[model samples]
Every structure is written in C-alpha cells, then in structure tokens.
Target: MRKNSIKNIRVNEEVHRELSNIIRGEIKDPRINPMTSVVAVEVAPDLKTAKAYISVLGDEQSQKDTLAGLRSAEGFIRVKLAKSINLRNTPEIKFILDQSIEYGVNMSKKIDDVTKDIKED
Candidate 1:
C-alpha cells in the first residue's frame, strides 16, 4: 500500500471541508461549543470509518463535554451525511479531541516566558 498518496490527500481535504460546514452550520446541538473547529479528517482506505479531529477553543472541561455531546449525536450526523453526500455507505463518524492547538498555545507561552526571563536577567 502506498503511503501519503495524492488520492488520500484529496479525500481527507474534501471530508474536512464537508464535515466542518455540517458541524458549524447544520448540527444544532447546543452542547457543541461554537468555538469547535474541524481540524482534520482521516478516512480509512476502505472508507468504512472516518475519524474527525476537532479543536475546541476553550478549557479542557468544555472540550471534553463537547466531545461527549458529539459522540451521542453521531447517528444523526451520519444520517445527515448520507443524505448530503453521494456515497454507497456513509463512514462511521468518530470524534477525536485534537490537542495541537492547545499544544501550540502552551509552547508559545513557554517561549514568551523564556524571553521575559532573559530580558530580566
């Protein structure tokens, strides 16, 4: 199996765009934090499953709660996807907590702290 091929990249990009729009504009669950962003989408080669990486722009607890809400609403989301897209089978939707945004924020804070310390010294 070839790795990081053009087809995989295209599919992942398309999935990300569609999922983002659906979650932001279509899904009406209030528990879903409005700050939530669909960061990436990973679809299996067989297209049986899709893991959607989401970044919640808030505290840790808020992120966890939003994920729980999304998980419970998976069936509805899948049905909507089936209706919206032309596919033989709508992939099982899995919501994943993406910590990259948090990580980046933390790293920037650390760097800022170091710079401040150096300036004080």
Candidate 2:
C-alpha cells in the first residue's frame, strides 16, 4: 500500500471534522435522522473527490433515508465546505452508509455466545 502524504491526511481530517459539524448542526432535512453521524472520510491525494462514510443509529430505513438526504444536499454541502476550508478545488462529496457499528455489535454478541458455550462445557 502506498503511504499517504501528510497534506492529504490533514485535508481528510479537516474535511471529516467540518462535515460532521455541518451535518450535525446546519443541515435540517427531515430524511436525515438526528442520530446520523460522520464515521470516516477518504479523500483523494489530488483532493478531487471524497467518500464520506456516515453511520445512522437506527433501522435500515433510517440509514437509507439519511444517505438519500445527504446525497440530495451534496451540492450545498460542497459549497459550504469550500467556503469554510481554503482549498483550490472543492472535492466532490459522496455519502456512503457505514454499517461498521452494527457489524461490531453483531460480532461482539457472537463472541459472547461462543464464550458462554465454552464456559458451559
């Protein structure tokens, strides 16, 4: 794997932070649940595109709605992001549903069940 440059990493972090704040505070879309959160962001070295992972603390329907809302507001979000951060070119934002939290919870439960079985034996 190639190592990412310091500048690219920094840009990713700043964008992640700014996006989290904007989604949490500024955007007021009914489809976007209050439990929605920015999980991670991956920016290209050229800063031309960014994939933002968002976690929705709710059912599948909620997650779908949140992603839809973010995708719809992509333009507005990019504009706001560019205004907030001094970048030569604003990266295109793509919203993706992050199910890591749910997967982790499921894994934890499976581990607990296995441990319980081992203890029983």
Candidate 3:
C-alpha cells in the first residue's frame, strides 16, 4: 500500500480511535500514567501488527514507567481489542514512546538560545 494513501489513512484513523478508547476506559492497570495520550496508531496493511505511539505528559522517569506499564498490559489490551473490533485477527500492539513533543520543545529552546547569542554579539 502506498504511504499516506486513502487506505492507509483509514486504517490509521480506525486504529487510533479504538486504541484511544481502550487506553482510556478499558484497561484498568494502575501503573499506566493517567496523563498518557495515544498520539498516533500505525497499522500494517495486513492488519497483523499495530504500533501505538504514546505521548506521556511527564518527566523522563514517568514516561519510562508508563511505557513499562503499557508493555506489561499488552496481552490484556489485545484481548479487549479482539472483542471490541470485528477483525479476522487482532493486531499485536506495540507501545512506542513518541518524543515529537519533547523534540519540539528542545528545538524551540535551541532557537531561543541562538537568537540570544546573536543579539549579544
């Protein structure tokens, strides 16, 4: 399938919605940080695997702990997905820490520093 094509977009949207609901309401794990958000979901064409990118609103340690919690609850999440979505096979879910927000913050800080140096000079 072509990247960013119509089909891929549809799959991504569906997976994202399902995952958001699962994380918010279904899974009852206490270890999962309450501030976690399902930033994006990428599903393969064959629908056998899904990469769920999560943006955690916390410091580095909190993010790491949240990821660990999600990883441990993968089986429970998959079971819920299988029952929730009508598919031949429920895709294996993989939790990934999405650092785009952090990257943006760092980039902005760098730009600010550069501007300050230029003004000083």
lDDT of 1 by residue, 1-121 (tens): 2236786677778778878888898888888899999998988876678999999999988998899989988998888777776666688989999999989999999999999999999
TM-scores for candidates 1 onward, in order: 0.90, 0.90, 0.81
lDDT by candidate, in order shown: 0.85, 0.90, 0.87
Better of 2 and 3 by lDDT: 2
| lDDT of candidate 2 over 23-70, digit per residue (tens) | 998898999999988999998877789999998999999888889999
Worst lDDT run of 10 residues, candidate 1, spans 1-10
Looking at model 3, residue 47 earns an lDDT score of: 79
* TM-score, structure 3 vs. true: 0.81
The residue ranges of model 3 lying beyond 4 angstroms of the native Cα positions read 1-5, 109-121
